[model samples]
Target: MLGGRAVTLTVSSLADVSALLAALPEGEAAAAAAAAAREPRLTKPAGSLGRLEELSAWLATWQGAHPPRFERPVARVFAGNHGVAALGVSAFPPEVTVQMVANFQHGGAAINQLCRTFGIALDVVALDLDHPTADFTQGPALDEAGFLAAFQAGLDSVPDGADLLVLGEMGIGNTTPAAAIACALFGGEAADWTGRGTGVVGGALARKIEVVAAGVARHRGLPPLEILRALGGRELVALAGATVAARLRRVPVLLDGYVVTAAVAPLEAARPGALDHCQVGHVSAEPGHRRLVGALGKAPLLDFGLRLGEGSGAALAAGLVKAAVACHTGMATFDEAGVSDKG
Candidate 1:
């Protein structure tokens, strides 16, 4: 049994995870070059389109075409209750994690609304909540078996025919674990990585910082995967797995804010080029998020002071990606429009 629940998977150790994920097919360089060449010939001032041009080129490289398809985007929100929530880290209770999962299923959450607006399908993977991982401040949050199981759940959650993926998470007190993971990976003080998740402050916030610091102190020198095993919540491990899986599948990933970013930090560490498969949808208002994004070397598409998770930022950014694709494909060249090029 794993996480107080039975979990079935074929793999035994973290090493098997690398075997399960192959390198992302290098996005088509020829196609990207061709798209870049076409952009200059378009009936517009040079560089007038700004980041849309970059987005289109990115899509072209990944899709192996000048005009890439951005349809059938999928958003996966992994839900779990963190054992760290037993501390006063979050303003919300742990049960809210389960309640939010139901809200996601019932189409009542903000993410559901955003996904509907963007016409993206939503999938929520619920981890074993009957037994949340142990408090990482004292012990490993998940045993090796449990961590492997959550990782597999992430890999299994990726749906077929998804042109792109948006990753999100729902777990009360998750920020504590995420911050702990970041601190371990980035070599920072607990205060550098910790943030006020769900708006906890004063004594609650101080306690949260202490808890993350303790977790980081307890497991500072472990391997990347072991740090994840020791300090990560089930949902976080699952999201990291999903990011790697999406890369292997050659699907681009739109990453949601802080917690999600922290979850993937170790994956990026384990596989150096893996994060090239993803783009940040937005930077969360959470302080640790910006540091993590910088660590990944990604510039966010939006920066609206959003701290809400559950794929809200990713869903909003998907529309912009789709628009970028449309503009890249639909815009006419100077030759086609019979307009003379500026010599």
Candidate 2:
């Protein structure tokens, strides 16, 4: 129910999307173009700065400042279990959720490693969707009334002074729900978004699609909240709420993979401004992922064919953001660096 309140406000028209898109600073594109033009004359070989210069311009535009600043970066990973796992949609068992949460807490997960490397703070939250609730005694699960409560807890836990937020997931069998949700939002076949989640094999993949299709069928014509109740996982709901909270707080969100993006759709629909703070980390290897990004009108930063969840892509993309900020803040202007200006 955490995101339930927010989901009720979903946007249902392209006009809504247009208005939100229009609100983003027009100066960002102009700044990026200017940076692209200026990078060639910085006393270095022309275009030697490569993507770094482009990234800086983007950061400047996004932050609405000539030089962007990345003061504090935080990665938030949300974990939950799914009731649909009974249908064999995932290769890994539900136990992995608890295990991975523990690993994250103890500093063994990939997110933890990446955060340490980048000097970004990490926050992990465990939510119970409907099943495997016994393991996550430390966190609240989604029930009729506890949904919003869980989401608020996660929102409040985000560290003070954080400038960027990266959202990741740790739920077994979640891809099934994510695919179903994407298909509903985009009106696509379940198979289109289905992939070998956590190394699920051929037959398992087939069964996963079948099960998700059934869920989608049962929930047809229902509202987004009801669809979520019937087919969505708690982690997804919580992530959606967090996305809204981040937007309201004016903190940029670095999105990881499909599951996280799926969670954000409801928020993006409800408050189009919510997405202005989001940066797609990468184009996930999952076929459905590209479709989702396209639907959201976003271009991801990387394309290494990575399918691993846990905010890995977001963590990796953080380097690009840092470099962009550095270029904006560290690079000297034409007059200050004493570089010749092209009249």
Best by TM-score: 1
Question: What is the alpha-carbon lDDT of model 2 when measured against the actual structure?
Answer: 0.69
Model 1, runs deviating above 4 Å:
1-10
lDDT of 2 by residue, 149-217 (tens): 445544565554567788888899888888877776767788988888788878888898887677666
Alpha-carbon runs more than 4 Å astray in model 2: 1-66, 129-146
- Estimate the TM-score of every prediction: 0.94, 0.81
For candidate 1, the C-alpha RMSD (Å) to the true structure equals 4.7
- For candidate 1, the lDDT comes to 0.85
Model 1: per-residue Cα lDDT over 1-343, one tens digit each: 3112333333567878765443345676788899888889888999998998888888767655666788889999999988889878899999998899999999999999999888898988899977888989889999988998999888888765678899999999898998899899998789998888899988988899999999998999998888988999899999988886676565788999988888888877877777876889999998998998988899999999998899899889998999988888888899999999898
